[model samples]
Target: MEAVAKLNNYPTSPRKMRLLADMIRGMEVEKALAQLEHNPKHPAVPLRKLVVSAISNWKQKNEGGDESTLIVKTIFVDGARTIKRMRPAPQGRGYRVRKRSNHVTVIVDTK
Candidate 1:
């Protein structure tokens, strides 16, 4: 059995989020949370919360299971809609600015 959680439209680039996700992939839940808690990364904060949420989901699904055995089974980040804006450039020209966002999914299962 497994549990899944998702974070949608997170206001960060998929590339940035994937960096943190890769570090925690296949790691034990408790260790991952501890690593995320102390890591000095912007996206780590939200990713930490997402893991906690997945743990909660696992509890709800399995009434009597050891959480220590849980692991980050699968995780992925996908690019979301980009917010486009115009920036003023020299010589009365305009530059395009894209604010990227991403959707993250985490699936946890017993090791």
Candidate 2:
């Protein structure tokens, strides 16, 4: 059995979030949470929260089952739409500004 969780519009860019997601791929649920909790990166907090959500999903899917048996089977981060705007520069010039967002998906499966 498998469960999935997603976090949309995360404040971090997809590139940055991908770095953290790569570290947790194919890891057990417990170890993934531990790594995220101890990591100093800004993206860890959101990733940790998503991991917890995925665990909850697993628990819900398998009633009365042990969460310890669940493992993170896949984690993926994708680029979302970027909000673009123009910033006025000196001497009547304008610069394009891009505000980035990301979508994160985590899937867990039980042994």
Candidate 3:
């Protein structure tokens, strides 16, 4: 059985989140956590939390099951709502500033 967790509207670009997702995809739960813990990327903090949440969810579904064999089965990021703002330009015109956001999903299961 797979356990799932998600982070929604995480206030970062999907590409940025995907980089970390790629780094941890198909990795064991313990190794992923270790990698995320030392990662300097801003998204790593929330990503780490998301993985922990998945572990907790797995624990809930399979009571007393050992998590040592668990791996990150699948993880992905999708673009979310973008916040657009206007920035003043040199020619007295407004430039559209897009603040990208993303939703991340993580699935964990036994190897």
Candidate 4:
């Protein structure tokens, strides 16, 4: 059985989000949750919520199924549209600043 959850346009770079994603990529549901809970990274918060939502989705899809055996089957982050802004520079020129965003997907399945 599999369940999926997605977070879109999260205001964080894919590189940073991937760090957390990599940490819990193949971990068990319980262990992953614990790891997220203890992690200080900002991305960990949404990732943890996504995992919980995925687990809830699994439970809904398979009534009476146990969640203890669930593992994060796949989790990936992709780049989203970047917002560009101008920052004042010393030479009367505006430096382009890119505010990055990302989309994250999590797939959970029974181990």
Runs in model 1 with CA error above 4 Å?
A: none
Candidate 1: tens digits of C-alpha lDDT, residues 1-111: 899999999999999999999999999999999999999989999999999999999999999999989999999999999999999999999999999999999999998
Candidate 3, residues 1-111, lDDT tens digits: the string is: 899999999999999999999999999999999999999999999999999999999999999899999999999999999999999999789999999999999999998
lDDT of each prediction vs. the true structure? 0.96, 0.93, 0.97, 0.95
TM-score for all predictions?
0.98, 0.93, 0.98, 0.98
| Clash numbers, per candidate | 0, 0, 0, 0
Q: For candidate 1, what is the lDDT? A: 0.96
Q: What is the lDDT of candidate 4?
A: 0.95
- Please give, for residues 46-66, the per-residue lDDT of candidate 4 as tens digits: 999999999999999999998
Model 4 earns a TM-score of 0.98
Model 1 weakest 10-residue run by lDDT: 59-68
Candidate 3 runs further than 4 Å off: none
Best candidate (score: lDDT): 3
Over 28-89, each residue of candidate 2 has an lDDT whose tens digit, in order, gives: 89999999999999999999999999999888888998888888899999999899999999
* Backbone clashes in model 4, listed as residue pairs: none
lDDT order, best first, reads 3, 1, 4, 2
Off by over 4 Å in 4: none
